[model samples]
Target: MARHVARPDPRAHWVLLLLGLVTLLAALSFHGLVSAVGGGSGPDQAPASPAPRAVTTGGPVLRLDGPTPVSRRLPARTLALTFDDGPDPRWTPQILDVLRRHHAHATFFVVGSRVDEHPELVRRILAEGHEIGSHTFTHVDLTAAPGWRAGAELSWTRNAIAGVTGREVTLFRPPFSSTTAAMTEAQYEALRNAAGSGHVAVLADRDAKDWQRPGVPAIVKAATPQGGAGAVVLMHDGGGDRGQTVAALDQLLTRLGTQGYTFTTVSAGIGAPDSMVTATTGARLSGTALRWAQTGADWLTSAMNLLLGVALVLGVVRLAVQVACAQRHVRRVRRPRRRLPEVVAPVSVIVPAYNEAANIAATVRSLVASAYPALEVIVVDDGSSDGTADIVERMRLRGVRVIRQANAGKPAALNTGIRAARADLLVLVDGDTVFQPDTVYRLVQGFADPTVGAISGNTKVANRRRLLGRWQHLEYVIGFNLDRRMYDVLECMPTIPGAIGAFRREVLFAVGGVPADTLAEDTDLTMKVLRAGWRVVYEEGAIAWTEAPSSLRQLWRQRYRWCYGTMQAMWKHRHALREPGAGGKLGRRGLPYLAVFQIVLPLAAPAVDVFALYGLLFLPWSQLALAWLGLLLLQAGTAAYALRLDRERFGPLWTLPLQQLVYRQVMYLVVVQSVVTAVVGNRLRWQRMVRTGEAAALVGGAPAR
Candidate 1:
């Protein structure tokens, strides 16, 4: 049973994150490029002279240099009405409905920007038998605008219009120009410039000044024809609240019909075929590029939304479930726990030391000062160059043994200590931890059931002077202790921290004496004991104070090792899930909880942050802020409850809110990098943390007051 087998390699969930980040960046880049390309021509295009209009006092004043057709003539009793600057989401639909209700066909000069924003409206414009044409891309004055900008203003809109509608737009309307006779120097120059390009310029014969939002009657009077040869009336369906425009259009159409006049599209009224792009400009490539760009952007946006939704639901549900279970355990733990047997057997305490000279004395002294009558202390120094073994040997304390060996690892050192011990009950302690006098006695009492293989002791951080230390202290209580309550109640407690835990000797021996393959040997061994048919429980009364990492770098490294190692152990023991019976409850109950709360939830936490940023930029920031505060309050409540249950003071929890802002994200990044490294086959070496001799001071001589 002590023989070990090879474990499975890693899974590549890390790729999902890599791909997710890459694709998200790609989507953002695509959007930016589309914006630049849609709204601008190349910045290097040459400047051009001001556009010239047909102003000569000649017959017909026909502008031959212009690319678009100039038409002011029409049949009798026929009105050619044209709408420009459209595809406005709010007003466009109302205009479309009015056109549909009145059975009218009018040309809409759609702005490229609005088309991109509301492509559905552009489709509706085309679907409703209306002619679509360019409105200078962004309503810029083409006559004074640079030739390159003007060129792109015309061409990009045509490309985009085609991109969305699969139809070419050839009709052009110079922005800020009203009619053939009523034109400014720049407007006529713009007409000449646009005609130099391949677009037909359409000028309205009548201006309603609807954009000024003059009263409905004024707009009607401006647009109402006064018994003339067919006229081209200009009204707007977009750019602002077109309620008055819609009303004015309805009134003018009723008045015109009563006067026996018919409405037609601009192209029809101008004696030209409907405008459509029949030739490709520059977009006729493999077609895959645009499709891929669109698909990737769409997918990334959808994924972000999905992540936000899932993270919100899972975070809330897990918090609720864990809190409810913890409360139940609190009520049950208040009931008197079972007492250890009358025969308080002899016990062996193992202190694994590796370059721990700064703190070994406190560990040995705490164990030696134990109230239990029968106790033996073994200090296993795994080749500590810091004179750790020498310190223990120089103490010359009775029944204290020192074993020196090459630097293997904590697991190997522990196995050596187990072999040297002569007692059936064992306690394992890290060299930096200081235990209470009665902790060992309190710890072993859980094994009174005979079936209980191991008991986990409550480990608290002794160093809490720094902000990081305070955050860790809060985490130890709220995250670790509260979680242990639920795990203990479930009978599937997985880890017996190396800081302070007692195990029955035979159970440890049966489970292969701490395999060195995993970083979290303690967790690996505990799961082995469970699979080997042994029960594990948490004993909070057995308390020890250990030092936490002092800096963010140290904290990151410490957590990386722990998280990566725990993942390894979880993967290693995954088979236990298939086994039936009460002993496999660790696999059935404990594993799922760890997989979710520890692994999956932490991995998905970035979604909450990402979504928070997304909401800040695009969604309702006030609601997002409220949701964040609610989660923080929920965490505060949990921390308070755990502290009360542990008999710990709540002063450190003042930093809890700050922890959410900074410390929590650091831990999340640690988990993310750890998972990425683990999946990518990056092996992590075991390194010792630099501990300050501060552990003995904060918890010196006895338990904290």
Candidate 2:
């Protein structure tokens, strides 16, 4: 089981959140109008009630055409509390107790599936005089493909709930709160047409992001509203975990009760009446509209829930991996080497060159000057049309060999060099990368330990004068280094830096050389080595420096490929994830951890995206303002800590927010794309980022003075 960490709410700008109610109302009103006018059946004809209008005081007024809600005038204090998306056995009862204590009536949009398992809860909800609303069968987000499945979902839940309550349910809340103009129109028409005797649709005015697992404070903050306005605060009684939600409601309701607030049922507040009408006809109609509405509503609901399930699974998977791997530690056994070994085995340093014309010479020079005993620098030029390889050839360095090849990509080039290597060990470096004089010595020394099959070097951005470069520097220090340490602890280092990584020649051969099919050869090789029972070690002292992408666009592309490649590698080794380690119980716990923490997390991130936007658009101003302050402080802390780690970089600390604004979403997008690709079985080929000549052109302001 993965450790659960509550994600901070995204409504970071609490002070600026005052307009949420107004925005939500406006959106609701706009949607209502668009649906009603655009081919809607008749004005809501259900038991007498006023026309649906988005209002601050009241929740969504359902305007039905046939057997639809009859729009009638009502007082501002006439607010109906509507909860959607649950029948959570864990939390729904707590919400019920509070409502019963307050003698307040509300509506619960129960999921169909939940009602089937816990029939008593649905019966109790209905028996207690709280109106019941359909939130689809599975609580699926209706926005996904195969939108028609919602009909079955709705019918299933409705029948289950009715079986227990022996009462008909009329209201419907689309899963994910998503309703298209077409779907809404169809749902309204279908509901009224299907209305039997007396059933009405329930809509909400206010929404609390209880589904997101916000803490009790944040939940209360969102649920409480501005207090002055008579409002229907939306809460969930079901779907996933709602423990915090149930607990928060008790506090919110009690506090509000002290302030003399009250709640009412939709039927009672709107004034019960006989028979609903088709909104279009404003006259009694057949049950056809009601059935159509039910069908459409169900399909829509199923689509939404399906999407939500996929998202949830992704998050849970990542969480599982992170938790499982967090405890295991990989022992780092560094061999002591005071001097170079005698008869110095010839070393082949393979540099996979792309368009590195500017830095190729310098990179080659660094390799030539390495203080190793015997070394052979093989620069496999991966079809760089630029003068990169030419410059290396012109240098005529004694031990350096420039091998020109067609543009077969990085993995292929590395494979070529490995096949040709005559040395005992092979060092792979990117063409644009430059290594320190002592890097080879430090890297080779680790091989003295027979278990250390391959070794990774620390990567630092060579140029950090620019803000982007500086931020990248901090990222390497805080993000990469921390990750490396964590992976070292787990004994499953999943990726070796492509800039400079050394491997035993035999180990490379055993893994069938570098996998040519994957975009991330280094990551693929790392997993393969671990799977084959070879241990990977990290050389903290064997540092290599290379240029970092200078702009957000460049960084996005680079990181995007990395993420996509990671997913590909994860897919390749998924079987190993379930394999037991030395014990018969579990083969490799580390693989599972990597899958959950690194591969599965990107999909879960979308919840934060939705929370951020919704909070800005719907949350109360004060709470929104407070949330923003909290977010800012968190960002500030992250920046300060990151900067402290890489104080040598100028703007790394100051650029944290900017990085979140420009870069974070890109990362999220890449993660999302990776998930999509994995599901669709799309193959990712290696695509190198174009190197800017600036890093090489940069003259020393002061080199490690």
**Local accuracy of candidate 1 as per-residue lDDT tens digits, 372-473:** 999999999999998999999999999899999998889999999999999999999999999888888888887778778888999988888788888998
For model 2, how does the per-residue alpha-carbon lDDT over 315-407 read when each residue is reduced to its tens digit?
Answer: 445434433433232222333444634335678999988888878887888788888888999988888888778898899999888888999
Worst 10 residues of 1 by lDDT: 37-46
Identify the candidate with maximal TM-score. 1
Candidate 2 lands at a TM-score of: 0.56
- Which segments of model 1 are wrong by more than 4 Å? 1-104, 110-129, 134-157, 170-255, 271-275, 279-281, 284-296, 338-343, 699-705
TM-score of each: 0.79, 0.56
Candidate 1 whole-model C-alpha lDDT, 0 to 1: 0.77
What's the lDDT for candidate 2?
Answer: 0.64
